[model samples]
Target: MRQGRDNGFQAPLWRAIAVYRIAALTYATILVVRNVAHYQRPVLAWPVVAVMLAWTVFTTYAYANPVRRRPPLLIADLLLTAAALAASVPVVGRQALEEGKPTLAVAWHVAPVLAWAVAGGRRAGITGALLMGATDLIVRAHRDQAALTGSVLMLLAAIAVGYLVRIAEVAQERLQRAIELEAATRERERLARDIHDSVLQVLALVKRRGAGLDGEAGELARLAGEQEAKLRSLVAARSVPADGDDGTDLMTLLSRQESPNVTISGPAEPVRLPPGTAREIAAAVAAALDNVERHCDPGTRVYILVEDAPDEVVVTVRDDGCGIETDRLSQAQAQGRLGVAQSIRGRIEDLGGTVAIVSAPGQGTEVEMTVTRLT
Candidate 1:
């Protein structure tokens, strides 16, 4: 998602620049009035002061909108500053220039540099400062120490302000990311609560009822019991934050579902997985167990095996219960009973994994789930 631009420093920086522009205009007007008698062309001086005042008012309005501070406007602003500096040579004459007297614009030239710094960071600031500084030196026709000193100060101000602007942008980006993460966490917690109140409770009841039954009904009850345990573990673990590293150990989480009727066997070492992939695989296993509990005998034996390969992880859930007929799944789907399709197959597919079910009418059922790490 695109983040909103950070304007945290905009108001204060522009406010200060507006004040500086007005003050500089006043300063320049006073200098012009004081030096009017010394000018070779006194008549031309008043018109230049009038132009400077008008431009200052226009820039103050233009710069208030960030979109107006683009390259074209910034370039024009610098050009205008240079023009004002050049006008001093004609209006104030060579005597004042040689004496290092402040030009008609005085501190007004800094407006362009400050604008560039706020809009384009260090590079643009340096460009604007250099343009103004070089123009001032050329108009003076000599390396006046005061002029050089002013140029150096302006350069330093541009660099510092530009650096601070960059820092603020990075801080704003991190703030946006933190906001997105908090929102996602809240949504996950809400979903977990809803699942607990409905799905988890239903599976627990099915497990309890099938405990003492015989034949396929007994096997179905046992399968329900295993699924109830697995789902509960998944829901509980999901409520807590997962490790930010590779992921939580898959074997450790799956082991939590082990019970008298459910045998879980895996490697002794930790089998790591990305947190999201691990949770989906665990949930798929729970759904497969739910299927067994609803269809197989209560005393049916179930085995869960975990294999950690170099590039992928594989989990297999097997049940020695009355097997599924060839058309059973099709019939279930047609009847709008989507427990197997949505809960098991749909989940694995969404994770870029594969689900393979092997079963027959009298034979046992085996579901193999595989997810690659690259996904």
Candidate 2:
């Protein structure tokens, strides 16, 4: 992927490279014209400089579009630049090069190294630098400080540009994340305001009015009160602090499902899983709990168990409720109720995991999800 922001420092860097190429081309052309008299093949030097000028113009437009900046184009740039440098050997003549006269390419060869650095990072930049530098040195046919200076500078430029590219990518990623977080925060606040004005008020009223009644009336009141508290907690809950790029602690999320009627058990230490995987598992568990809440009697017991292993993680949500016939599930799917299939089964399967649901009439439902971790 192109490493830069929508409005970032990296975009300007490419333009800078193009500008450098143009300036270097001009410098090289001037040197070739001025020193033509000293050249062994004076007529040949102009053609080499002309090719460099054409390439400079080509790359200026080609690299401006990000879609054209791929490995194939980068490879072509590096090889063609090396070829231009090699052309110096015959055009400038070996003896003149030995006498310290500048090659036909001169500063123009470094442009490809900068392009590699911007596109592929430090290692790729270094590779390009070494190849071009070696070509320059071999074409010059000498090994002195004067011959090595350009190569060393190219290496340094590659390293610097590659490092800066990495930093720019990180900065852009963080900036995008910050913008998303701000938008999410605003939406959450608006939703909270609406819930407070409507749902919470209605729930509180039901709890108060129906509390003194008997049988299902009181039970309904208790459920409403419980839902009100859960909704408040849901809206007010803070996100768990991320544990670097490794993953999120799965136990922390599962523990959040704990309630007066629900029990969660897991390893004492943190059970770390990839963030997306952990959240999907937690959501599946939540879906199981929801099924228990909607279908089972009030105060039905739900137990969540998490098992962490080297190659896999398993989460089981078992509820001691009035279980249904297995055929009922198929019937429900056919009738368009897909909470169990989509939320619980589909989520685990999408992550390359397995979901085994075991339930029978008069027996409780047990949802066992096993996700194998990619080492």
Q: Rate the local accuracy (lDDT) of all candidates.
A: 0.80, 0.86
Q: Taking the candidates one at a time, how many backbone clashes does each contain? A: 11, 0
Which parts of model 2 are misplaced by more than 4 Å?
A: 1-8, 240-244, 255-272, 276-297, 300-375
Scanning candidate 2 in windows of ten residues, the lowest lDDT window is 1-10
TM-score of 2: 0.74
- Highest lDDT, which number? 2
Top model by TM-score, which number? Answer: 2
Candidate 1 residue lDDT tens string, 138-177: 8776786777998899999999888887888777766866
lDDT tens string, model 2, 1-375? 343223356668889999999999999889987999998889988777778888889999988877788888788888888888888778788899999999888899999999988888888889899999999999989899987888999999999999988888788877877787778878888999999999999999999999999999998999898888778767775444334356888887876677668888888878888889889888988898999989999889899999999999999989889997869988999999999899999999999999998999879899999999998
Report clash pairs, candidate 2: none
